[model samples]
Target: MKKRKILIIGLMVVGALALLTGCIPGDGSHTVAKPAGFFSGIWHGWIAPISLVGGLFNKHLRVYEVNNTGWFYDLGFYAAVISGFGGISLFRNKKSKND
Candidate 1:
């Protein structure tokens, strides 16, 4: 029970930190020399859950970058999003015949 409590507190702290430091999706208008690309999309997608929660309190935050490499960025974003969530199911414990 103590371990569970510590784990929960640790997770909360990590989550709070992530919310405070995670990237914010935007139009990229401020960066004229470079636009977000595939790798950026992947990173954004990975932290999207935290961003969503942060967005609720901060109106300036967004979920997707407007200025990007188009399809490549979209592909990376979708790939990460799918893999991040889908990978969890892959670890499910299957019933053994003995059980």
Candidate 2:
């Protein structure tokens, strides 16, 4: 019974993720006179999770800008991604040797 319950929950989670994946970064193509730069990339990276959720309901919304400054934008985006998510591990409490 426990295994069946787990299986159902797992499937639900996977289904939700599959649905959400449609809104992932770089999936949309838009044309803009002014392309996003490094700072915009940083902001976009920080708000990526929110954008993903928003994008699902709003087709116009996207996690990544289609018009951007290439390498600089990519660097800023990746830097923010690594720092924002990966930095969370830095604050975790470590187990004491006595414990």
Candidate 3:
């Protein structure tokens, strides 16, 4: 029980740090460019298509911009949801008639 607590605390700290380092502007002096190979995964790859779909149409030149923003914000939210589940029975969590 104590170990689980500590492990969860550590995961929370790590996740917070990852968010800070990845999203937050560091120092703000440099250009704060995207990290190399940051978008080198299956999830990263979906970002482009998802964002494109998320930003279907607009008169102004804002498709790519909307896509990029949607990619990060939406993907981050989904990642959080997946992590929260801990790969367990989300739908069957409660004591139901089937159980």
Candidate 4:
């Protein structure tokens, strides 16, 4: 029963995604604004995983911008990637009375 329920839910989610994808209107000429500057790079990096998934379904979508301010954008993107992937723990309070 549990397996059947899971399968049904998965199918529903996939169907919804297909429907949404179908709703995207255009002759494939819709251009998404690429992320620029440090802040935008950070934001894009943070959402990179999601962007990657979205990009898989839409050929026009990109996970990272091609044109940016170089080093600053790279730095921000690295920072965001590190922070998003558990690097924030480096600044956490590790001293607990119990330990």
Residue-pair clashes per prediction, in order, are: 0, 0, 0, 0
TM-score of 2: 0.62
Across 1-99, the per-residue lDDT of candidate 4 in tens digits comes to: 999999999999988765544412222423355436787668667777766778878786676666666799789888888998878788888998888
Better of 3 and 4 by lDDT: 4
Cα lDDT tens digits for candidate 1, 1-99: 999999999999998776644456762342546777898889778877777877788887777777778899899888888889887788889889999
Error of 3 at 39 (Å): 24
Whole-model lDDT per candidate: 0.77, 0.77, 0.41, 0.69
Index of the highest-TM-score prediction: 1
- Ten residues in sequence with the least summed lDDT for candidate 4: 22-31
Model 1 residue 25 CA deviation in Å: 1.2
Cα displacement (Å) at residue 61, model 2: 0.8
Put the candidates in TM-score order, highest first: 1, 2, 4, 3
Local accuracy of candidate 2 as per-residue lDDT tens digits, 1-99: 999999999999888866655434555532466677888788778768877787889787888887888999898888888789997788889899999
Quality of model 2 by C-alpha lDDT: 0.77
User: In candidate 1, which residue pairs clash?
Assistant: none
Q: Return the lDDT, model 2, position 71.
A: 96
Error of 3 at 52 (Å): 36
lDDT of 3 by residue, 20-55 (tens): 333221222223253212232223333334334433
TM-score of each: 0.67, 0.62, 0.25, 0.55
